[model samples]
Target chain A: MDWQKLISFITVLVTLFLIVRSEIKKYKLRKTRPCGSDCNCAVLKEVSLKKLK
Target chain B: MNYFAIIGNPNCGKTTIFNELTGLRQKVGNYPGVTVEKKEGKILFKDGTEITLLDLPGTYSLTANSPDEKIVSDILLRKRIDIQRPEGIVCVVDASNLERNLYLVSQIIDQRFPLIIVLNMVDVAEDTGLIIDVGKLSKLLGVSVIKTVGIKRKGIDELKRAIQGKFQVSTAVRQWKLPEIVREEHEELTQLLIKHNSVKEDVAVYDAAALLSSPKQLKEFKDELKPEILDHVLLDHQRLESLGYDRHSIFVKSRIEWVRSICSEVVSIGEKKKSYTDIIDSIATHKFWGYIIFLTLMILMFQSIFTWATIPMNFISKGFDWIGYQLGALIPHGDLHDLIILGAVRGVGAVVTFLPQILLLFLFLGVLEDTGYMARAAFIMDRLMNKVGLHGKAFIPMLSSFACAIPGIMATRTIENPRDRLVTMMVAPLMSCSARLPVYSLLIAAFIPNLLVFGFWNLQGIVMISLYMLGLVMALLMAFIFKKTILKGKTPDFIMELPPYRLPSLKNILIQMWERSVLFLKKAGTIILGVSIILWFLATYPKIENGNPSEKLAHSFIGQAGQFIEPLMKPLGFDWKIDISILSSLLQREVFVSSISTIYNIQNADDKTVSLKSQMQKDLDTSTGLPRFTILTAICIMVYYVLAMQCMSTLTVVKRETNSWKWPFFQFAYMTGLAYLVTFIVYRVGLSFI
Candidate 1:
């Protein structure tokens, strides 16, 4: 392969990796935090439960 | 590090003081079980003594009627194992509203923590012809008092010095005497709690009084406490009721009387004059003029958003176009160049060009909030909201949803009733969040005429405002339906305190604008950029070596997927290309613009200098031999975006807030179903008019 093709290939790979990593991180964070990272919506379930009580 | 909590009533300038003390060193999170925000920051002193200052959610008292009050009470009583109890407390109060502010301070004093009273907004008090003898007030309250104007950074040094100084717990503040019979019962209950519940000596009296009045807390302690303590509390409550004394009123009345005595002694009024706030509020909150002013402001804001943003948006658009032209020249015509020029630049630029609109929206919201007009807006909206069976408190969250739905949903915690809160959450996403602005702005600017309407209002601005009003009207309609049918409830009485109008702090407004702008830019660089590259690859690969660009795109992976969905979208006047954009935008609404830009870039690769708008205008339907996107189609698209539940983050937050998947899924199904039905109707009806 030519040098330009090699560079493009690596860039695509890096892009794919970052996208996949971000999705995984977001999924795990959602499971644990539920509101995504930046929002202040985490721990709402406990509050909702208290409201129910 | 020593921990000190800052607690105050709402609108007491507590947050401003907290920001002044801990500039950029702050973290925001949610306290468990309530939507109250947990804001913590580190205050570093000159001598290297580090103190962690927690900005507790603003509450009137430790009465625990709402979650905010409960959280404050819990923290002060050291009941929350998740957070360490503060070693001391800094109780902030509005000096201008001293008589009412002192009520909460009296309750905090009962908690018996080493406390300091920071008299905030003292300048506002002085302006109203009120003079407070700070020294005499401090001696009477038995705590150190530091006068401050939090917004101006006045008295910050002395406030910090007090925080770092040796703390003193004053016993003299609780001189208010309860009736003898009630005092005997309270003492007995306090002893029982101390012995049986292991309650601390300093807070047992406060807890005993709280338990007697609040049945919610009594029920909470039922499971953990020994039955003897429960029986004792019940018996004490009965004994107090047997007499002519109301258990709750005794504590409240006695405290108020004492606070009133203290205020009368330390505060003196000079020659009175009406302030600017009162002068303005006469019209701002008047029944008839208020609505007119609000409508005029809405019109002005929408008009300015379009007119003021044009220059900067054009500059950004031209800059991106020039860069794309340069990149096309610098590299060979191949996949690498296509990825850079068509995919990344076009996609990011399409979204980035809308930054001015986003910033303007945030700036207006900031000014409204800082000038205390937002609260008045809520007060004004209360009657209409009540007509729809929603509390006035719900209007603030709805207003906030105009910026974004996540924080708006989180802000629903202030509504104490579960049904009302749930109903608010179910409809908040219908408000057009900032994410939808790009889609609306792009379509409006391209399709709607920019001529003056009646020689005053811009036609484009009117269309934009119509779309926003459509979202709001639909939201209120949904809220009414939810309240009447599924989550039926009565609208509770609405009471809100309107803070006096003050000049907005430019520094604070700019900081908010900068923070929100950076968030927008970050999303553009990351999620939008990623989706752009992926879409570009899907459109470019499996290349037909001998075919034209359109032919190659038609046979690509993305093209096939879009074709699969094209039949479903045809009723709305959308083709395969628009179908792909709709599908990609499910992750976030702004991605719709980026997806469209990327698709157009790939199709018109030979002409890199044409703007996206011009390219879109030039697109022709092969079958009809007419322009692809007509005014009808643009209106349909805008209507669809206004109602669609297209954001994943909002869905996740709804799930978290409800603690069940049932509500979020229900919300999604209804919103999307509504969007599809409305767009179809709009398309069919619009076509008839043509």
Candidate 2:
């Protein structure tokens, strides 16, 4: 076939693959890393105040 | 309605006010084709008026040293800038941190921008028992004042009314202009100010002092000033420098005083209560426990991405193979049938297959950043960052690369030191971003078994983690090496402002995620679409349909092409089939899968029963009459994709970020060379066994 059509077809196929791949990955994810980890990765800054004399 | 450019120090609630004004509708995208994200949105007035609000990067002053700070100066100047010149600017000041934030606002006043004083974070002010008279402060600064809690979306309508009335009403009362006393102090040394340029004759003294403080700027003004009066201006500036009012101090003191008075008047402090942010930060920044918690969070992100992303990937594989069959059935057994099944559909499917992981990675990163945890992550890494000759602030960009290198590279602009900035930019791309995950996943899935490594962990997962760690360690090593050798310079001293910890607004977080996802689809999608089409063509075309068709096309142009390269790659455990796959992989590394699938499918016309994976395991090489899963071939493929310059999108990013082809060209060359050498070693070593 012509180069243009081949390119067009590949574009469509890649899109389909990406969509399907994402969905499948999502489906598998439910089986792993169930979100409630006790790891407190949230960051914050601390300021120490001096006591009044 | 008048436009208001909400300007403040980087972490001083400027973005929060912008978010509050726009309400989850702002568009975040690359500035034109550049990587710098330009934020623009509008705020509607109470009287149905609309004022466009620009949220420029936070800067200490308009002296404009870095590109980010330059943006603040450029917008305020409205000269040679691409965006609209704001009619007025609502300077957002954290009442608690008035000195630094007001440093920018006072500079804005000199630019002669219409002014609205937005005393943000008044809640914090109130908690501290700080009382400020808003009306009196407004009179002192010659502008209107509005108190706002950007996170809670409070005092918004009042802000809107102020913006709407800015053009019609004159807020100019007490001028923040430099006192004649300060100017006279300089004049005692010489009449340099009047002699230098006709421009400064009517200009504010604050502007003149700011220019003199900058060494390069002082020289530039001296050189540019009319030669006839240069001596007087130089003499005057020297005299002014002696007066305890050097330009920077005078400038700083002026804004500090203005902000201090304004904050004291209207804000009232009540009982001191613990902030939600502080409570959470204590754990996140625990001296010892913080690191452990951070490690666990990281492991979760990686593990979840792989296990979660693989399911849809399988469905995608099956669906594409099925479509190939259906198209093969319809095309009357001609070249078109082959083209549809093998060339177009398969080519696109290979690249498209990885979208799920990319989207999920972006979504997770978006939440991390919006929640303020990401900044805290930088804070935690700062002590470590200093050892590597980078500021704690530089770690923010490095961490940002885990989601993608493009944004991470753009973020390096925050590094003030020119040497450190360039070093960060060069090594950032080495980080194994989410885009590289598919290559790692496919290789490990295909070659590495589910065997336990070191008794407990999965060997495949361990290998995957190793590759990522290797990249990071290399980046650090390279930065150290560059600092000592190529970029020999003293590392700049570190001074980073730690923003207050706040529970990130969920409304704002979701909006950021949506904007990023849409931008990825719009910008990266277009380029990927183009590349996908081109790759598909290289796999198809020049078909042979005549008698002895297999024999006729066996030695066709592509075969001959592959044949020429076959001997060269044989040491790496690659035959022509592997060579062709590598060639077709130019668009992206993952295309390696579909490329092999298409080639093998054409050879086995009994393609009805076997899946793509099955076909690969079953296909026999004529030379050996055995399956093609040679130990050498697997190693070669893995190493090649691991370091190769396979993604045009990456090169596109490099070009845009550096604003030149020189950097991207060097990037492609170095990475490809590194990939070739690494793959060669792996393939040759594997071949020794087979």
DockQ for each of the predicted structures, in order? 0.36, 0.02
> What local lDDT does model 1 show for residue B25?
23
Model 2 chain B scores worst on lDDT over the 10 consecutive residues at B27-36
User: DockQ for model 1?
Assistant: 0.36
Which residue ranges in model 1 land beyond 4 Å of their true spot?
A1-10, A27-45, A49-53, B25-35
Give lDDT for model 1.
0.83
Best DockQ among the predictions, by candidate number: 1
lDDT of all predictions: 0.83, 0.61
Q: Over the stretch B498-616, how does candidate 1's per-residue lDDT look in tens digits?
A: 88888888888788788888889989999999889888888877678887777788788888898898999999999898889989999899999999999888988888578889888
Task: Summarize candidate 2's per-residue lDDT along B28-100 as a digit string, tens digits.
Answer: 2111111123366777655676767776666777776555666666556542344667777778887766656
What docking class should model 1 receive? Answer: acceptable
Q: Candidate 1 chain B, which ten residues in sequence have the lowest lDDT sum? A: B25-34
Model 1, residue B190: distance off in Å is 0.7
